[model samples]
Target: MLPIALVVAMCLGAQASLFLALTSSQDRMALAGEHELASTALREEQDSLLRLLKDYAFWDSAYQRLSLRLDTAFADENLGLYLAPAHGLDYSFVLDGQDRTIYATRGTAKTTQTALTALGAPVVRAVSAVRRIGPGGDPRVVGFTLVEGHLALFGVSAILPSPDSKMRERPGPRALMILVDYVDAGMMHELANRYRLADLRLTGARPGSSANLPVTLYGGEVAGHLTWSPYQPGTNARHQLLPWMLAVGLVVIFLAIVAVRMGRASARELIASEAKARHLAHHDTLTLLPNRRAFMERLKLREESEQAGILYLDLDGFKEVNDVFGHGAGDALLKAATERLQSIVSWRGILARIGGDEFAVLITGPLAREGAECLAQAVVQAFDEPFETAGHNLSVGTSIGVVFDNGDLSGEEMVRRADIAMYVAKSEGKHRYRAYDPSMERGRELTKQLESDLHRAIGTDQIYVLFQPVVNAGDGRTIGVEALARWRHPDRGEISPDIFIPIAEKSGLIVALGRQILREACQHTRSTGLDLAVNLSPAQFWNDNLFEDITSILEETEFPTHRLELEITENYLLRRPEAAAQVLNRLRRIGIRVALDDFGTGYASVAYLKRFKMDKLKLDRSFVERIANDSEAASVASAMIALGQALNLNIAAEGVETEDQARALRIAGCTHLQGWLFGRPQASSTLMAEIPLSRRA
Candidate 1:
């Protein structure tokens, strides 16, 4: 149909075009495949080799042997190494973090000297790069420290075999090794993706194989991969391509792309995890407020001013609520109360719940006192509205103790003072608040001082006994005296029993002091020939053998038991009614007269007056002090006296300071009186000379 020459030309053109197109397509497919396979194969080879390298990294034979020889933890216990084989580079050595060579066994092993420069020669320098190495530069060392002579933290670099060495040096031991110790969740994800395992993704992307990636699996950038003989198989990929005549790369490239992406995601996750951990450490898990540690840090800064206050708020009846409504209701109530406190004190103070049902607010500036008071009031008022819990109406109270720069106190000290104030409020009556009193502070300080002094006092025998004369009150006849202890301080002069008596009670030194005083009084009885009266406390009465101790003293001293009088409070009788009755009866049987001291002041009702066998009733000074002002007080006194007489009990009025008061009591049928008007509390030796009451009686 056409010319022969034109047909020939068309045939040649078509044949050439077909040949060129086939070549171009084959080249592109081969290129894509090889690039992918090379990347994946390189990664797979690297990973397998890395795993083998890890085996050597944890080579217990070497690291454990070294640690046992050093007889210490030398480093983090796990000596680490890293090998970067993909970039025609590898380094290996024992690293003391920072890529600083703790020891080295690269091609050039060190036998002796170890300046970091020589020890960290090849692998070490690369691992210690300050910033991550460039796409193709050698590794470098960055951060390292020998902390407290204990641990050499290795945060910066990975030390491994030489970069120049080829991989497969030991079966599958690649030249690159990394510390698995720091491999976090993200890093584990990276490792999982590197193998092209299922659910293994890179850069949040799904991958068919290592087909079209520009980089490899290692965190560092990789421009190339060297896969030698003994190539591993790479099939069963989700996506596969036909093999080119001269290429095996598509799958590898696909895998590599996935690996790079996975590494990045892992990095991002690691950062997020670190941030969350730091935040949690400073915050309270329950309230989401700054915790005690964080609060202390803030308080430490304010301590420099010494001009701060604290509000110690304690839920007064929280325990009762817990007992009645269950802990769940209590917890809900606490949460509600905390919210109330939070709302009130948020602007002017730092509030924290340092203890269970005990919250505190630290204050700065002059407003500390005012702000603390305001916050404390709000906390008290918060519970005024009854809460419904478990179908029951629940009510609670708070006792707030406020300290407004009362004195410079530590955080613990502030807490203590606030606690004391809270206790004071509770003691006075709950649902109330109190400011820190200077007297209370002084009392605590003095008590601490007394505690210290008491330890020395017994050893040095600084306490000595003094006797005060007790009289018949009627005939002014001299009776045996009361024994008292005087503290002869080395520098501060005398401390009275009133000051140290409470100290002794709180410190449990009362028993010891009582013993010393008793021994001293008996020693006096051994010398005197008259009646002796000793005051006993409720605490002392807990010892059932108190009468025995007294009898043993009297029998040993050959002193008449009838000449001794034992005085106790009605409060003590109320505590141990049956025991008190028995002990009093026993003392009377032994011919020792018993006197009820401070009788009307305690729970000494008319029923008790008749319940216990008694010989005498001693009127408390409170009633005696008001005799001149209040006729009702005198009537109370007369009622007590009449009750005593009705029970056939001798009546004694104490604190009779004036002759007029004594005359009034006598008119009211009181036969005995003891006061300064009669005689001061002078030493027994002085009283023996000043009063001639025995002859007058």
Candidate 2:
């Protein structure tokens, strides 16, 4: 018994010693990681400055202006007060061919204009080093510098003379230099916050401190040091160490008890975390409903259950909500919709937000089919009341498809069939419900095939453009042509734009389609001198670089922008009015004519007419068709024409299929006309020869 007691005592001492050693090693490793992280952050900042310098130095404009040595105005406009503050740069310098500073500005505000004579010795050294490397060689020179009592990271690069020999008529050597922000107390604190280090500061070297990283400048000179120390407890060292000593003593007294409790607690925590993860994986976060995975699981579990029905529901016009009111509003609308749906489903039905605006429900009971249909009707009725989301009173409709279990169908099969029915309900008319029918499968197959073929068509040379002539109402002479994109599926023949345009929009292919159409139109009409009008989709506006796209097309085709007219619908403006207005303003400034197409078909507020600069308004065919008989339609057409005249805007009557309709439109004071009467949409080659080139107002 005495020998056993002595061995146990020796084991406890050895274990305590091992714990202390491990704790010290962990502390050292943690400190090393913090120091390494700080150094990386500093190096990343240096890299960022080098990238900015390269972007400015390698540019064609910089090359031309710097080589000439006569463009101080270039520096004044770009490197003055705005550039430094906007880009978080400290100093901007444009050096001439002979490594002479042509323009230099320092500080965040450019208030301190830096001259070559006043340049700091450290900065001059960096510039001289980059010059020695020569322009058209290395792109960047990075180093630290001690300037104005602060250590700053400096980057310098030689500006390559333009590859266009025309710009280098007179030049020697050219380069650009920039001084990044200096590392001060505020910058050090910022770095500490980013790296989560404590009490980071610049300090003299500590011989054995692993937390010290050396800062080197040009010519391998030591600029300064970046150093940090470990975080300390708020209390005295004695108080901080007291708890640890007590813990060690307790560990020695109840070693087995402490180990058992810790192991159990860790096991319990791990079990709880894994359970939460599994629940989250199967549940929708937004609606707290079963997700697709969970829904499928439930369906599989209840496959043999009697009288089960699966109802698949999709919200119609949901995309419009996202496009018009934004994704936040869409989310809010979905949440509100789920609550309404929940009330109808109650506790008996399993409701899930499958994805997006789609929802699925699994119902079981003797009257499951009837209950499902009733619930679907209730959902349809619920949407009749407008949804108030973020001050936008939006309206949406639900199309539901219900499929009752036939005792043989799997859950996935039932859901797929129900989805097919839902699409059919949507196609027939939204805000309705339909029970799954086998006949619907054929149409679904066709849709899938069409989508697949469309993908193939887009990848190949199957899509083409045609032009439709817009003629004067009185003389029946073509004045302008509207370009129309057409798709000729190799096996299916000519596909209507109406049928494929929506597909393109849904598939996110509209932007590429619009770009191709624009390019084709510009190329076709470049020399024809006929005013060219191209319809622009609302989706096209989402491309923030659309202005650059138009500019590039014009430059490439050399098409006269003044003769190119872009027609957009009022819905496009309503979706994103400010963005549309900005785009229109840019287009108008560049000599492009903007026109409102399908004018009466959308939200026609005269306020939009006043806000947007439009060259013309094309009267929709609905009003034109009604003008032949409906007095109200005739009055609206006359009113629209008068409004256009009052605004000094051109009004064009479209879809004029009959002589009577054309006559009525002409009598109503519409200045221009387009449709079947004018000419069907045809190849540009055919229409170009028909319209004479010589015409003026």
Candidate 3:
């Protein structure tokens, strides 16, 4: 009987020990889950705040009124009043390019105090960090800060123009918009309830008895601690099991069995959670499509099959949809686009969203190239119908680049080639697909080299401005000279403007190049008494500092603004009619002349011509070349000139090579004629030398 009792006691003790160990393990797992949940909740809150700030900051109206114009009324009406009670924001501030507060709001009321004054050095640090990152950075920041000794969450974002804005690519200083939310009783209670955290509160120091999360500031300084009562399942379970253990030894055996089942259930839950995390990591959150990582992984694992193909696609005019509508609409459009792509791709390919408005497809098996082309064509056709999203019918197109594996290339190389082709397709014109070619790669390399060279050539003698004489239509005498940029490559000889000019524009080097050309032309013609015409790229024209840059150049060269004629294309005018009108009016106010160049090539209508109020209309060369042979072309050219004449605008015919074309233009009421016939684009020195002789003629 004694031996049996001792054995029974040993069994009971072992059961109790096993029970305690299992409960303790479960408790640790529970605590880990709670910590992760709390961390994720904090991160989610930060992301939500950032999204709100982005919605406001990346807007045309916000950029224009707050950053560009600093309209206080607009800020109060649109931004300030919407904060506080509506959005639960404590304060909102708009800082100018110089980090000075241009607008501020406390709750729903406008405040005189700046972000720096209200929030202290933290605001300055955040702004400085964002500026340091510049255009390449995330452009938005969210972090914690101690405002008035209270823990607060803040988000700072650069005031950037919407994707559809004409000033999207125009480089300049950016204003910052800041939104602050304080951690008060109500916010703590909401967080506690949302995260299932008990007694969650912000404290100045870490609590010994509670689970604490450090509230880090923008610069990584620990501002405060968020403490919460930890739920200990192990301790609770042990207390409940202790009474059973003391009452009956058999209860320990039953509790141990229960604990074993609970442990197995917890293990299964953990495995499922891990699987969910993996799925999320591999898939896009919006479309649930395999993301870039998954696509690349599959690509790398692809067999060396001759029939494999890749297609890279980019959405054309999607930015306009985002800018005009909103991000919500943009997201809906993306999902719609994904659905359309999936319908086309079906089971033939693996589709993934690689970047913003960019997608990739991988296909294998027989006739992969043909299949890719078919898929590409279908994808392009799918977007032909406008997508109805957010109660708005938005039209967007896609450019696709297709590549077939040669069995020698890696997956990354194939994707890269496809990307290059896609860009080429976009450059040629959107809503089309281009197959990857060996020559295209060579051309891409050459373009990169040229872009690098062009950067170094600006403001140097390697890049010089040449002048093409604009002659009187009847007498053929030089009246004004239009400045044309020319580049003399050191090794490759003279690089055509047709090649380098586009490169400069694409690289944002056109701003500096345009300025240099303007200065040189003004300096050369300051004493020549010749009206100076200089073409402004869409980039240079839309530059925020355009007026100031032009004024400074004119002043530095002592060139009269009245004698300056800036030529803009029809394309630029169609981009933002209202904004272009304002810019044109401002130029006219300062005694500068604006001309509509390459007329009749774009979507400029009669109303646009009248509304823009330009000084001249330059007929595109297509009309001139066709006018000599095609009577229909001559009539159109004549009518265009007649319209310009009725508007009291000068009509300049460009690319006049023959006397017949010249006579046709002259009879059609063209005031100015420019072509090789008048003398091809020459150096400023050549024009200067001919000035006296031209005057003699």
lDDT of 1 by residue, 298-354 (tens): 666764655778777788668666644466777887777777778878778887766
TM-score of each predicted structure versus truth:
0.44, 0.49, 0.56
Query: How well is each residue in 612-671 modelled by candidate 3, as lDDT tens digits?
Result: 888999999999998978999999999999999999999999999998999989999999
| lDDT of candidates 1 onward, in order | 0.56, 0.73, 0.82
Q: Give the Cα error of residue 253 in candidate 3, in Å.
A: 41
By lDDT, rank the candidates, best first. Answer: 3, 2, 1
- Per residue, candidate 2 scores C-alpha lDDT tens digits across 503-554 of 6665546777888889888998787767889988866865666888888988
Q: Rate residue 564 of model 3 by lDDT.
A: 96
What clash pairs does model 3 have?
Answer: none
- In terms of lDDT, the poorest run of 10 residues in model 2 is 231-240
User: Model 2: how far is 623 from its true place, Å?
Assistant: 4.0
Tell me which residue pairs clash in candidate 2: 97-173
> Model 3 TM-score?
0.56
Off by over 4 Å in 1: 1-401, 405-414, 420-446, 459-461, 525-529, 693-697
Off by over 4 Å in 2: 1-305, 322-356, 359-395, 409-413, 416-461, 506-509, 526-529, 555-558, 570-578, 600-608, 631-646, 667-669, 688-697
